[model samples]
Structure formats: structure tokens, C-alpha cells
Target: MAVRKLEHVGIMVKDLDQSIPFYTEVVGLKHQYTMTHTNGIIRLAFLAGADAQESQLELVEGYEGELAVEGRTHHTAFTVDDVEAEFARIKQLGVPLRDTEITTLPNGARYFFFYGPDGEFLEMFQPAPGR
Candidate 1:
């Protein structure tokens, strides 16, 4: 069968403890469960939004540092309702942003990037209509 939807997005973090709160509070994702890799010193935490149909956010820890030298990109962006409001809320938390302004899409979506507590890049945005 063909793919129906994206299942989840995986993020690599330096520490789960530091990254978890931002996902739960700022991004507002709910923790589902965690798993410890049998063959490595890695941990995985899967989180979901209120709408279960959407994909989950998986946080991977312990596979970072100097060993992870390649392949991991900067960050990933997820859909949001009001990017401006979300920016205001997160800015109030005093998290130093990697960039201080919002990026605009050709279709009018507003967005920006910031680092999570674990220093992982995270992008949030509000999409334009028909986008």
C-alpha cells in the first residue's frame, strides 16, 4: 500500500531531560512512552499532539557529541496555527533564539528557528492558506 501520512519526526538531543520540557510545554506535545536501545546507549521518547492523527515527535538521546559527525541536519518545522503568538509565548520564556525574527514563506507562512535546551535546532511555523 502507499503511504498515508508521516508517522513521526525524530530529533537527536544531547539530553532528554533538557529537551522534554520544551516539547511538552512550549511546543505542547504530550509524552507517550520511552525506549532504551538494546544495542547502544541510546534512549528514545515519543510524544504526540492532542490530535492523534498527526505524527509524533521522537527524541533520541545519547548518540550525540563528537561521535555523531555527519548526516544530522539543522532542524525540522511543524505546522502551527498562529506563528506570531507562538513566537511571543516562547520569547517570554527567555530562550535565546538562534535568530531574532520570523521567516516568511512565499505563501505568507511565518516562521523561525531556535535551539532546544539540548542545543538541537527546532523550527515552528504557521502555514499560509492553500499551503
Candidate 2:
């Protein structure tokens, strides 16, 4: 019918191995799979929520040198049903990531940040429905 759900978030990471734990431990998610499309062109890792589906995090590594620096972008925030646990877990990780200065959104959504090898804002927010 319509769109099933979010597929995955594509991130450009300087290193794949380094960002694994952040998604695994900090976010309390699992690495669904990893792949290399070419010898030194494209590499990726996919992460999914522990209790949910239809959405995943894609960590793309191996875009080295300056070719990967063209129009770089920022991190993304995934909506969650619970903010306390999400915010706490990310802070507990101690990963080098920046966010909206601090967690807690205007709509009472809570969030935090963590970098993926390269310094970028990876945000996670939990919002109450019917807001």
C-alpha cells in the first residue's frame, strides 16, 4: 500500500568499527548486518531497534580523503516512545557527540547526541503522542 516505515539512516563515518558500540550499547540496539559494495568505495553497517522494526540505522564508512567531504551534513534524531531511557543510555556511553545544547524538547521530547567516528550530531528524541 503506502510506505511501510522508515528504512534506515545513512551516515558517513570515518570508521565503521568505532561506531558499532555507540549503536549497540549506547542506543541499546543491534547490528543487523554489514556489507562492502566495493574494495574501497562503499562500506556499510545496519542497526535496528531491539523491540521495533521497519526502521534501521545505516553507518557508511570508507568514503575517505576529500571526495567524502563534499557538502557534508549533520546527525538525525529518531523518534522514540520513551525518553528517559534513551537519554540516559546515550549520556552513559560517553561518546563524543553534540546535540541541541541539551536534551528535553519543547514538546517534552527528550534526546541526546553522539558522534560516529567523525564529529557529527546524532540525535535521539522521544516524544509523547498527540502532541
How accurate locally, in lDDT, is each candidate?
A: 0.69, 0.61
TM-score of 2: 0.46
The numbered model that scores best in TM-score is 1
- RMSD in Å for model 1: 13.4
Question: Best by lDDT, which number?
Answer: 1
lDDT by residue (1-131, candidate 2, tens digit) is 12223344667777888888887988788987777643447676778888655567778787653434654433465665655665556667776646534454344445566676665556665433563
State model 1's lDDT: 0.69
TM-score for each model: 0.47, 0.46
Instruction: Give the clashing residue pairs of candidate 2, or none.
Output: none
Candidate 1: tens digits of C-alpha lDDT, residues 10-70: 6778789988888899999898777675435878687889875577787878765353547
